[model samples]
Target: MSNSFSDMLKKNFNIDLNKQQKAAVSHKDGPAITLAVPGAGKTTVLICRTANLILNHNISPDNILSITFSKASARDMKERFNKVFGDFIKYDVKFSTIHSFAYFVINEYARLKGINFKLIEGNNTSLNKVRILKTIFHDVNGGYVNDDKLEELLNTIGYVKNKMIDISDYSSYTVPQIKNFNIIFNKYEEYKQRNNLIDFDDMLTLTLRILKSNPYLLDKYRNKYRYIQVDEGQDTSKIQNEIVKLLCANNNNLFVVADDDQSIYGFRGASPEDLLKFEQNYPTAKTFYMEENFRSTKNIVSVCNSFIKSNKYRYDKNLFTRNENKRPVTIVKTRDEHKQYEYIIKKLKQSDDLSDSAILYRNNLSFISIAEKLDKSNISFYVRDSKLHFFKHWVVNDIVNFLKLALNNNDVQAFENIYYKMKGYLSKAALRYVKEQDNSISVFDRLTTYPDFRSFQIKNISILKRDFKKLVKKRPFEAIRFIENSLEYGKHLKEYCKKTSFSYEGTKTILSHLKTIASECNSIIGFLTRLDELQALIKNSTAKKNNTVTLSTIHSSKGLEFKNVFMIDLIDGEFPSLGSIEAYEFGQVEDLEEERRLFYVGMTRAKESLDLLAINEKNEEKVFISRFINELEYIMKENDEIPSEFSAWMKIGMIINHKRFGIGRIMDIDGDIITIKFKSIGIKQLSLNLCIEKDLLKAANS
Candidate 1:
């Protein structure tokens, strides 16, 4: 592949193909696979390879089918082709998504097999499942049946589906042993059949099932497709592999382009297992590795490599850049969660020059710290959070109103809201008591602690508690409910001002205005706090604007890269979150590995430098190095670099064993703890106790 392809590329388009692009173009026989990392010239390699095949190899573009993960990627590949090959290359060189290709192949061969199955859209699968669940349980959210069991089943179904468990196996279990499972599975399948719908999972699964049952259909597609290329192989599903396997029977004409390190779609049923097991299945498959990273500095690569090296099963690769090393990754171990938030907020103000800087966390709400400082400093941020609009005065800021009524113990408004929502459910006492009240407090406040709350007498405070809990889940709608209910209940305050009596209409107008404010709010949380400006909400608002730093979990930081990265909480309970445990002692092997991968991902997001920090004590703010620090040290030391000590990580614990007090374990693990297990003294519990944690780290040798 020489100047014909090169000339065609230059004539049609000008793409800056780096060494990687040149390498791919120069591979005469072509590669069986290529693994490209994020932001690499993978697409360039693709177009260049395609151009070479047409110009030099003299292969018909029509014979090769290129598959990408997204429509945007499909357009990208097409543009690259058009840019390089000009009008000389025909549009017959097809490009489609794997699912689109699957549909095409299935449809093409369905006729040959004399089987007629209509192509179904993906949304239909889940919609049908929901409908079946609704029909089987009568109440989808579990109002009709045993609430706990229904919620359990729903959670189980969600877990199994997320883990990509083949429900066919679970669906076939003996009914007597798995009666409930069978019921749900059967209903879901029946729902799909009746609705004639398919989901993303169904596309691959159904195709493979069809191909397995009908080999001729598979053969027809196999012969039609002379060469196939898969992009972002990291996100490929198990069913995807099965299809690829069926198509690549000869093994010589397959091209896989992906980055296993970037396989972040496991939550969406993608498996790293598919990529890991590829070579095992394709015994004669040749592999090539790409290590020259164009992004980030050498220091950034070093930090990222240090982190990813912990993941024992990753494909061996290194990332390096020629740029001068810049600033190092910051490490901060604050006193508490609040201090952590403060640190992050501080970084945001300081990171003005770096466009890639972002606050990341395990939970979406991790931006709370950043939000707080924005209010105090009057700093502007996009609020990028999707969880809730946090401002009080804003319409979407109903959480403030609801919090006023419930958490602040405002009874009148709470009752009024409940009554407005369900006046029919009220007893005679509830009606009479409502008529006697001041009607000034929020609905949440009134409902929980009304003088007449005793009169309306209801069993089990659980229902009210659950109702309140449900409100918390919908931060925006909770705001709406608070307004409607407050308006329904509070009449006196509305009517007190003759010039401007606090009437239902008046409150509705205020709330409606607030909603509009929320809609235009730069941040939901900031918007939520706006209601604090209102006289009614002023007394209820408690969160003060402050110049606080932001602290959050690395998980929350996905898609967010920063110039300075500070990753702490790399401990058993944090980086390997307590939730990561399966039994008491054993870890979920996959979850642990994923966390390590997350660490690697976080490190790579840094530009010039990186810092790794871990809690010094099992439960303290003092930052310390992780045990993995030693492993990282060994590598650097072998290269004659001095190693950092482990003493940096071990902080002192508060509850200690004296000869008299005997051995004791810290009961509540944090800055403060009251309860303790004393070996000599049976048991001792303390509240706001004298237990204190000191800043003493364990030595590297010790």
Candidate 2:
């Protein structure tokens, strides 16, 4: 039967199945889970298995339901199925997202329960949704504890909802803020119910509730979908997994395709354990592993495999590829952001197809800087999932610019921006006087004697200067509070909101993100450094071109493949992020593991070439690269330096003996330095040249 199936695949689709793919498609009975590696042709197996169930097993097409993570994925599945089955494909065959399928089951039969529901437009932006929460939780005072807090609460609610936690069990929450979130969460849920509306998360919970209560309806669905195939099952939340379970309860004919190592959406309530422990959930379940990658080069796959192997939570599997391109992944180190941009432009210019390349980052803040540099170099690029420019907020812009100026008195661009925005604050003549003063005196110092300055304006300026000085020497949160109180930024936002009819809630939402970054930083200088990093990426409104390089966040780059992928800002505190600091400090190993998985996902997005970038600080005390990549073997090339094979000798996970630190595993590389975690002395960075000269390092392979 398997041979015949393979023969049919070749005849029909003009494609030959590899051993792993063949094994995956032939599994036809009971519950089965396929742990598919990236670029392993899982989609092909899914389509073939679905068609096989219909053609060979005589299962009706209407009875076989296919579920995917997104609408785009569903569309791809549908298009692929049609291409394979052609006119023989049934129109009733369903290809829908888990939420959409759940919505259908509830909306169709929910009328029997005397419930006629209308789904709220839950697809609105985060800020827009916060605006809705503001209206719902007015009793909390000041529209739901600021936008960041509200956004945090929203995330907590989704987390609890995915866990199927009852609102009465608030004590189950270990986090105090989530407990506070629980109280408002109930009110928010009640408000939605009162409006006869349901948000996206509600689609999963409500559908399960209705199905469990109505056994007759549950049985109908169980009978309807005799064969269920779930794609990207690693991203399935607990509630979503339960829905699939109940629908397949009686038939137990389920096929789930997932890569636990590719599971990077845990922040959004996705639990890869649902796929990992499939057999425990369904005793009859069988499992298959697909590890042959057909997309990226063998070297690329090896790096990704080695990187993810450190993760303790993933299924144990080895990913291999046939393409033997041994072009070592390039590690490009620059002195600063501008130099990094120059290196990227140089590479893009050499590329045969510009659109086939991409520049991915850990955060969206880097997008503005990269895009601007690309534009300046006459390189066109597109930003994926483009939102309204953060600088577009008139009131927020003025305040942040002022903060920037305070952070760095030499920031002339920031000075110009605030000066233009605050029309009534200073006269043009007074501005000219300050600008033309001795270069040694700061702008605020020059503002003291400007004759045209209003007395009241001078008073405000005096307070700003005094407080700004103190803030520079203070902690991040302290500096933030000083700016808030001294500037009365909230009051200014209110006035701006009234004048332009802006969503105050949205503006707050935007500011909350900045505040989170500020609070996490250690010192005012550190915070200012981040602020500068973000500011460099501000959207340049003047340059508008469609055919350009693609800039995207790692999370947004899932399911996307690029020929030449350049992942920037591979620094220690940035990629794994400062968020990982909290997790590491708290010993939340799972959170740290997810960060590694995110790195894995980012690395696997490349098909041909992958460049991991880092900037060696010139004036800084120490240079650091991400611990995630310390072990991977790659070539290291400093700006304008010839590439060397130094990294080829050292590999991640290989035990090496160091002089003072004893035996340890190599962890990361940046420029000429390599970091290793030693058993005796803990993690330390050593200069590669120094290590070799002193005979302090020994690679396990050697």
Candidate 3:
């Protein structure tokens, strides 16, 4: 509450609080927000302020509650408190996650009400919730369910819960997904109630309900946790903020440490709006800024600060670090993934310590080959991903291979894949004979003309030929249906399912999805092309690694500091991710902002040096460097292979779809000059990069 408390901190903890930190710690009343920048001494201020409240203001340890983001953070806070105060924090000083605290209050209230309820962990309980929803969907929709659809339903449910929306009010929502989410939510709630079970969300929902329902209990909690501190308050959801408000109603002794620029969890339903509008929520609240960064070098900090300055939705604060005269952020251009891997290997070899360096990506799929290369090099790294072998699913791969074959008749990879898997029906010797006869033709076509082809094989080939002809004339679904029946794919998948213990229903679900996609296609070729694009997009979608040279996703790299960070795959579609910009088309502005914040988070993780890597093209389609790269206040290094200023981002033969002119392919790109052959508008010459900059043309596959 006073400067004397700062003296106590200095004397006991050996921490002389900085001007901004001291101001934060001394503010002892009402609601206050400490806008702590990345690497700022937020935890120190939080701990010191809590200590100041307890010691100087004579606040009881029992009345103090500190809510952080995760269990690990809670533990770390407690550890820091213990180290700072030693024996002073002995009795009932609450340091727990918001969910944990909610569970505690809800469970206690349930006991007082003589209600028998089981608090279920959301992770383990999600499957049970899904089962209930799946059954309801099966009955309601006449049997249509799949993992992807169910996951979407789950996300919708999460959205509603986080937004504190009533399930019955779903019809009033404009989003179609929310309406479907409402249907699933109602049934799911009934199932939980019947089983006397409460999920993780129920903990917050029920706690809030109890507090609102019983004034006595609300007052009890309000008085009990008189001093409340919330960390990472920028990431608080609507429900979380409401719950916090209720707990702090009587005392109003609230302090929150947040940075809106660091609020990157909008996709998870957490809102920066909560932090942005905190002043209105607590009108008497005072705001403090902690702009000094203690981790990253001045150059690294400058780049991150400048990068985030573009976002109009965040609090205005520039992060400044103490360490000056460090290397400016570098933009490295590589030819391909292999070249990227080679650069990483060279860096690792040159580095003094492996742990000091990190190779961060937008997603896990980008590092599958890189991880393999590391493994071959005997480099140890940590990655968290599904061990389910879903990537190796026999039926899944078979279906994708078939779709690939339909896209390109001369897809040798698909031919080899199908030949090996269906060897029992189509002999290896027969495939060889067909290949020797005419290596240029598709194996399916070659099977028909092969001199020694068996009658059964000939029948299957005829089925393919019949479907192939129909695909050119009839709807695309006919091709998929014929392929399935003629090859007896369902029967084979069932056998494979039995052998691998893979779910038979999953195969059915996949077929259902395929049929749905096929129904939207005008031609088999068109469907194949779209499917290929979708698959590539999915592969590039985010999902992690750690050590030898720490490989990580930008999401996973938060709250971490590295001596050197290599932010790879900084291409438009990959870095910002495929949907961030497109979400703007759907009027989802916050989605794009969150993506920006994510890149900022990745940039700020570097302590001494940062390298942003991008390649010119992937899969023959030009990959634009992230717009963030251009915004950086530093010169980028250009490799001999890459054109000056990343001009190769708009390459010749790239696919473009004009809104007015229809689908077109680039014939040539000379400087800003461009030539395109539009199927509907005929040949047209337009400025290449300038057309994209003006939004006159968009990459079809982006």
Best by TM-score: 2
The digit string of per-residue lDDT tens for model 3 on 273-362 reads: 989898998999999999999998776776677778778888899788778745656666666555666666766777767778877876
Query: In model 2, which regions exceed 4 Å deviation?
Result: 87-92, 122-130, 143-151, 168-179, 392-547, 617-623, 633-702
lDDT of 1 by residue, 601-669 (tens): 666656554554434442122434444444544554443332221112312334455334656654443
Better of 1 and 3 by lDDT: 3
- What C-alpha lDDT, on a 0 to 100 scale, does residue 15 get in candidate 2? 65
Per TM-score, what order, best first? 2, 3, 1
Can you give the lDDT of residue 692 in candidate 3?
A: 33
TM-score per candidate, chains pooled = 0.61, 0.72, 0.70
- Model 3 clashing residue pairs (backbone): none
> Can you write out model 2's per-residue Cα lDDT over 1-702, one digit (the tens) per residue?
368878977987796988778778888878999999999988888988887777778888888889999998999988888888766666556789998898888787767767777766555544344566766566654443544455566777777788777777856653334424555787778877876767778888888988898888888888888889999998889899889988998878999999999888776688777877888988988889899998898767877777788788778999999897555566666665556676788779987677788899886656755665675567777777654445444444665676677778766667766653432366667678877887576677788778777788788668667766776776766655555555566566667767743556445545544554565578766765765554454344223344457888898889989888999877766767656756788887777788888888888999978887876541122457667656554322322221222454566677888767788988876656788898888898877644533456766556
**All candidates' lDDT scores?**
0.52, 0.73, 0.71
In model 1, what is the error at residue 243, expressed in angstroms?
1.4
